[model samples]
Target: MAMDSRRTHRESAVVVGGGISGLLAARELAMKGLRVTLVEKRSHLGGAVGAHEVDGHVLDSGAESFATRTSDVAELLTELGIEDKICSPYDGGSWLYLQDGAHPAPRTGILGIPGDLSDPSIREILSSAGLRRAKMDKLLPASVGANAKTLGELVRKRMGQQVVDRLVAPVTTGVQSTHPDEVEIESVIPGLQAALAQRGSLAAASASLRAASPAGSQVAGLVGGMNQLSEALVRDVLRRRVRILTGYDAIAVDRDPDRGGWTLLQRAPQLGERVAPVHGKYLVMATDAPTTLRILGSHLDASTIPQVKAGHEIALVTLAIEQPELDSRPRGTGLLVSDQVATVRAKALTHATAKWKWIAEEMGPGKHVVRLSYGRGNDHGPLREVSLYDDQLITLAMHDAGKLLGVSITRGNLLGADVVRWKGSLPTMRPGHREKVQQFRNSLQDLEGVTAVGAWLSGNGLAAVTADTRRTMHEFIDATSAD
Candidate 1:
């Protein structure tokens, strides 16, 4: 019972926004035999993850590095044949800032969860009492079957407050730019808790989990700058026969009461002209939450716009300096700040040059590049500019971080060196986020053809979620085929 539903008429569709999501979507649609147009507000293709060369050094302005655990990203590279650009992370070691010294933080602990905390590496960082709590993992009765437990409640109950404060807090914040007490445990630490609850002891469960481990390094990166991946998407999508508009900003959408298709109105600053009206049977909104609301402002309902208003706030800045100074930041995988440590706004750090050799090569023979990220800007705003002279705030962080990384600064050159600032963009998982997104889904059903996807649908992290959206889009296209 083979079904032949391929439509001979190639319907033209437009993908709004040239970010990763939009670029990916355009590629997928064009591959399905549709004429696709990729539009971007900015002149460049890479959104958060972009790169530029200055003084013979290549600098990643937004996102600098990504972990290898993302299979979807890897697959995309393979599909684009850009796999050779990826370089493995240096096993140079990582350090953590604590009371007044730098200690090793676990990077290969299998998604921040380890099978045995009794290992010397883990023991070196935790106090005796902390170690005792970690050992107690074997004694605590695990849940047989039930809803997932929060990381705060579960880790503190099993691994003790120190481990949670010292370990999980920083790691989670770095990855999601979110604090622990607020982030959903099921969403962040998925699989660990559910499996722990089922096994009746986290230690036993971890041991069992480790047995099924894959044989390879846990964290890896591209051979060139991490931005190369984004560049490849931009490159390949164009070759797929899709028209890309970089300076065209979509300002509004209108319905032709007479025709059922959408009228996409765009403003191209570069051209200093208005975009010729594009009539399309299908429209896909892949811009971030806030931007999406503005573009769909006129066409969508008031109730519909509020859903886009709810978002996440993450303040991330990348500081590029000489190799020695860049080496001056936390080395290895970097440190994570514990929630219990007075304030909990900042999280983990990674050596950009050390992590991504390709980008590092651009730093010259002895120079280095690194990214400094801090979440919850409202809290860090007044304190982020902390000074070492008389300001206890900056002094406090400098003292803590310096000791952890084992360095003393003789000048201001090492502290901020050459910082690139990007204010926080808060990402929210409020009480009714899923519900609101569902409403957004329903609102579009009334329209003739529209598709939406990205981190807004699920959680952050690139490849996996994009894969999920592609699957859904394929299903949608199949069901709506006009054969």
Candidate 2:
């Protein structure tokens, strides 16, 4: 059913974003017997967690899996009735491509930080001198790098620069699209410092954390695709009668003093020269940091508005190839390329068919799917690559795929190819990002019935976003109920 032609009168909650976080928030509000309206600027609901069709095959365009460090995402999947579809990647471990060459990544590690420095693979990637420096992490006192702010700082102080450049840099750049120097140690690995303090060694702490996690792959995805999670959330929220307004952008927001609620000024092409006012007793700003600040800036004090760094512009090039050599899975699931490697432009590549059995089965024999990601946070050189024409990017991806996979792949072998670009979707969590987020959240306490949640605040990955959204919504529900 279409929304009413005029302004909505005082809904119990208004979620200004239709991403996963916003959808989950709307669902939570509706479940608590509150009328909710979900507004999204894009025509589609899911933000980064979306799907695209390439070569007659539907694939996840953004996030494809969730971390299993916590059961938060798994439990949510169970509630959504798709838990049975959860599947793991093949047992083939990933690889790392450094300036030297390609080598298998350490089997037991977190974010490329080897849990056991004695692992033979570590010797293959690091020089004898580098390995000697890394082993010093075990000898160093726990308090040596205790107060280090960034992950790069902590690792360099504990291990060495070689380890940071060759090991950690590839993983951080591949996964987060940001360098380790810009990543907060605590934000990415919670309780790591405390663990370091207790274990008296960084390597020991990493091993302990890895051991505590659920057995098998640290990440998992649905049999179909993670896009199903977004679709499922949309379906569930609609069943609860949550009003969903796509293409409706919340341009301005303010407090309704007389009504003791919130008012959002929304504009859309569909509205055509008219702005619609949406009123609600509660508000959830589930947008990216920049857009959220734009709408709520006037209402927040100048000092209270946190300075948020812009996210990187990422372009993913996916290729479906009919390469018989790929049947051997030369590089395992895929390889994370070090930024220092001048030979390859892509920071990472995932052998989709080799990584996911379902995808392999869908493609049948002799057909393979590979995805290459291009972009590094705050790096304009890579931004230029992502800004290239679709055909140009596809050609570049094909070259990079051939180099990384050790296979001769040409256009003749390429059955189909596509490029998907995402802007400001993967937020960069700088060294002090978590502290700034906390300060910003504290400032919102003065604004009654208003809260904020997203990757910018909760850190990256589906697990962090899902867990944080549910927890924040539950808290909001409790606070609103008490009043």
User: Which candidate ranks first by TM-score, i.e. highest?
Assistant: 2
> Local error of candidate 2 at 409, Å?
1.0
Compared with the true structure, what per-residue lDDT tens digits does model 2 show for residues 1-483?
A: 111213243247899999889898888878776789999988888788999987889999999999998999999999999999999988788899988788988877688777899898898989999999999999999998899999999999999999899999999999888899988888789988999999998888888888876335689999989999999999999998999888777889888879878999988877695789999988999999998888777877778888998788899999999999999999999999999998998999999999999999999899999999998764786346888899999999999999999989999999999999999887888877887888888888888889998889898889999999999988776776576
TM-score of every candidate relative to the true structure: 0.81, 0.96
**Candidate 1 least-lDDT 10 residues:** 385-394
- Model 1 CA deviation exceeding 4 Å by range: 1-8, 107-111, 144-149, 204-216, 269-276, 293-330, 339-346, 359-366, 377-404, 408-426, 430-443
lDDT of the candidates, in the order given: 0.61, 0.88
* Backbone clashes, each candidate: 24, 0
